[model samples]
Target: MLKKMLKYLSSLRFTIVLICLLGVMFIVGLWVPQQRLLKTVYLEWQKNTPNLVAFLDTFGLTNVYASPVTITIWALFFLNLALVLWQRWPVVKSRITVTDAKIVDPVTASGYPFRACYPILPELSGDAVFAALTKKGFTLRGTTEGFYGIKNRLAPLAFMLFHLSFFLVLLGGLVTVYTEFIGFIDLAQGESFQGELGRYNTLPIPKMPAVGSIPKVSFVVQSIEPKVTRNTVTGIDVKLTDASGSTHLVGINTPYNTDNSSFVFKHLGVAPLFVLIDPSGKEVQGAYFKLDVVKGRQDTFRLGDFLFTANFFPDYEFKDGAHTSKSMEFANPVFLITVELNGKAIAEAPIARNGSMAFNGFHLEMRDMPFWVRFYVDKQRGLSILYAGFALATIGVIWRLLFYRREIVGSVREVDGVRCLVVAGRSEYYKSLAEDEFVRLFETAVIGK
Candidate 1:
């Protein structure tokens, strides 16, 4: 049973199946809204599709990367690759091995897969043939009776490197799974984030490590400037102030990285600060509502049974009883707000910046419309290892494709009473190309050919 299992584990078909399984998991991960990465989106999805969400949750598909099934698959993949390398190591080593001082006896033309016999001058010795092989880029290892020559001796190691690269990639993935943490945080312009556990929009994944690894640093999003290209908002350039008061300009492509964590731009939206005053004149609630709204779209939130729906107009304009934005620029901004109580529309009005609207003896004030940017923070330590594996894989591909492992044995022997040089060569790959090279080597070394 052990032998059979090892054979299965080391088989090429088993490796391909594992790769296909990983590919399927990757596709599933892309299709499903991962709860760890987008908690709010996942929650909304769960609310709308409770049955589907339940099925996904039961199978751990919602958090596929952190799922036990995913971890098990990775573990099995690592085991299989290791077994394959182990099973092939001895054979691969034997093929690539060469002793420089070992002598090889001369053989006839029929001895090798590709061979040629050339008549030489009587004065021309075996040394001449050996010298010709050396000048033709073959390393001469011995010249006792004949000569043993090899070229691209290290090319066979490329096969081992290919497998080792895969092993490193799997190891890197395992490292990331155990040590990495990801979370999302939103900070409106001028607001500060102290890098606390409670500041994240959703709790970070792998909560235990996140608690320890999160950088104890604070920074404020000072301002945001959109990078416009051809009148389209391509990205944003953010001015940030760190705890030390040093400022940095960051954007979607360039993240603020520190303490093994990176703050990458996820998205941007409008945040309207609101102050709700009760009829008794007490400040009941005051907070910023980070509404995921864009041009012509509305977003809403609720306070104690009263729902507030708001649509923002940057560069606000009103003509012919229609409210719209003249452009994407924030030259002028306004919010058309509606209030509903118990499913009945109580009030509706368009409020300018810092304007107030009233309904049912309650006052709601729009303090400001500040752009908020969401940052995806992650502490992923395995990235360097993964990059190294990729580098190794690239090198292996180049070496294996560009260099061919070949061996040539030449001997100065007597055939039918005529002194001749018997040249034989073999290549593990690119047989035709290697045969052409063999002809070139003999032509270059032979004085009479």
Candidate 2:
């Protein structure tokens, strides 16, 4: 059964199937985006083919690589490779032995071509032939009566080394699939805290503030020690507390990793707010009158239940009389805000650079912003396996490619009245070169006519 299995794996059919499968996988890799957010894909689909968005969502084709079906295909490919290697081992070993064996007193055949050129060549003594071949760039070794010479025996091993390298590459890929992870974390500037170690359902922020109340949902900043020389400091140290009453400290350069998940510091910014309440039992945040100053420019603000972020231009001019921002950059950030508690607008104000809005009974203000940081988390095990496989493959390639087994056999025998030198030589690699050297050895042999 083992032999049969090995024969099947090493057969041409199995190799052809493997090649075809690999080709399909390559096509899939090229056509399908490996990893992307579902929402992003949905949005793109909606933009292109709104009708098919629902259908596409039913199948997880957007992130093809992570999809269960794609992973299964990769698994099958690995299995095929393993089977092929297992089946070919015996044959490979047998060839190795045959190629390394020393040949001595090799029988000279009557129909040999070399004998036709020099009929007495085969009749020459083995020692004489060995000595002649050695002078012709062949390294002759073994006993005087039974000698061997070998040349360029390392060429055939290249195929084995190449195969080993390929195997290693496949293994590395498999390891990466299981062990590697990729995720993003968003952080605000000047914020310091050890990020969450495990996957948690809590929001990234301490609290979700009302639309316009930025102060209610601000980062807890401990301190800001500015560096005079460098563009950025090594890291900011901050403490974090979870609901379970655990505190952890983290820095910019030094992040916190738990359960193979990591949190990285990303960016920092401040969000200002304004609040307003009117007499009609309703409340509004931020005044609309302040919008006139940056009418043509971009405006961004959060109100009681709505968040509005927009770009503005200083020399605002619109083709259809609609005010549009000049560029996306927030050179002059402003918020012309208005808020309503129920159905009535109660407060209105203009929030300018580093300003806040307030209204009756409820007051809102801008506070210091914190740094925003990004983190990545993953739970794949294939990455490590793939790396290990790659290492093994590299070793295998070097062993098989750089090293070769060589052997030469020469035997002397008395034939007729002459001391006949019979040297039947074959090389696993470089057969032509080996034969040339053998001929040279025969030419140098002293023959008694």
Candidate 3:
């Protein structure tokens, strides 16, 4: 039963099926969006067919990669790999032993002749022949002659290492899926925020109750520098004040570390001013907007029935009856404002030079402009297992490429009272070269010219 099980596990067909299944799973994972809400997919699909959207969401296909079914498939793949290794190990070990007499025999019982025969010298014992074969680079082992002659016996073991590396990589991936969280945070110039531990950061909505629910970790912005001529921050200087009143400074590529908190300054942007007025025509509250050079226009805040948006121009010029921007350096900043009330256009105006847009007893003005700082928070899980797996894979490739086991064996026997020498060579790679070397060594030993 054990042998049958081993045979089944080590069969090439089994591995091929496992590999094909994994390939299908990987392609599906890539094509199907991962870690997204079913409601978002359903809403998108509702634009066409609400029924299909409901069906897809009901089946949990929106985030298939992280679904329990997909994870179970991957688990089976790992099990198959483990079984394959377990089944093949005994065969590999058996092949490593060279005691099989058929491998060294000169003549078959059917009288089929072998190649390159040499007369065995009387002075040369089987031990001497084995020693000569060793000199010729054949791996030999046994207490007595005719016991064993094996070369490249460990060649099959190379697969074991390769498979182990793959297993480690899979294990690391599982760890990442279960324990690690990834998210993005957007920080504008001079703006300070205590980021959530695992949430993707975006523009904070003013007066939103969810914004208040975010945990407060004391962070202060020191400076935000331009990464390029663009509006993005090349780097940022951050001062993190811990709960114990200890402050640590961190910058780009330099992380601030605390006992429970780790911070990395990721990105920076320009914070533009957005104002909203109440129904009584008084400025109630304003929201700060972070603008990216690539993102041209941003949505506005609503006050009562009026909506206001801000368009920022680093340097503005009029070309072909439209505003054109030259650079993002804020050399000449301008705002193109549009106000709408009750779904009707109220007034359109350009508010430049710290001015206000007044229409119908309403006043909107740029109040306060502050720079924003974006930082990432992380909790380390000791050493990253994925990185360690990658390291092991690199080492395995180097080992297989540079280190090859080789062995040669020569057996001598008196054939018609003539000294005959037979040599066989084996290597993990460059077998022909090993064979040539064996021939040369045997020629030198048998027939000295």
What does candidate 1's lDDT look like per residue over 1-449, in tens digits?
Answer: 99998899888899899889888888899999999778899999999999999999999999998788887887888888888888888988876778753344435433357788877777776677677677766787766256778888878789889779987787787676567767788888999988887778754543435334665668989997765443467778888999899998879789998777888998878888888888888877878888877656789988656898888877788988988888876667788888999888899988876898888889888887788898888776787888789999999988987886778877777789987777788877667777887787776676732
Segments in model 1 whose C-alpha atoms lie over 4 Å from true places: 20-71, 100-112, 118-136, 203-212, 273-288, 295-297, 301-307, 315-321, 326-332, 340-343, 352-367, 412-421, 445-449
Q: When superposed on Cα atoms, how far off is each prediction in RMSD? A: 4.5, 10.8, 6.8
Q: Comparing candidate 2 with candidate 3, which one achieves the higher lDDT?
A: 3
Per residue, candidate 3 scores C-alpha lDDT tens digits across 129-173 of 556555654565543233234444565666677678887787776
TM-score per prediction, in order, is 0.79, 0.52, 0.67
Best by TM-score: 1
State model 1's lDDT: 0.79
Candidate 2 residue-wise lDDT, 46-76, digit = tens: 6787555555444545555565666665676
Instruction: Tally clashes: model 3.
Output: 19
lDDT of each: 0.79, 0.48, 0.59
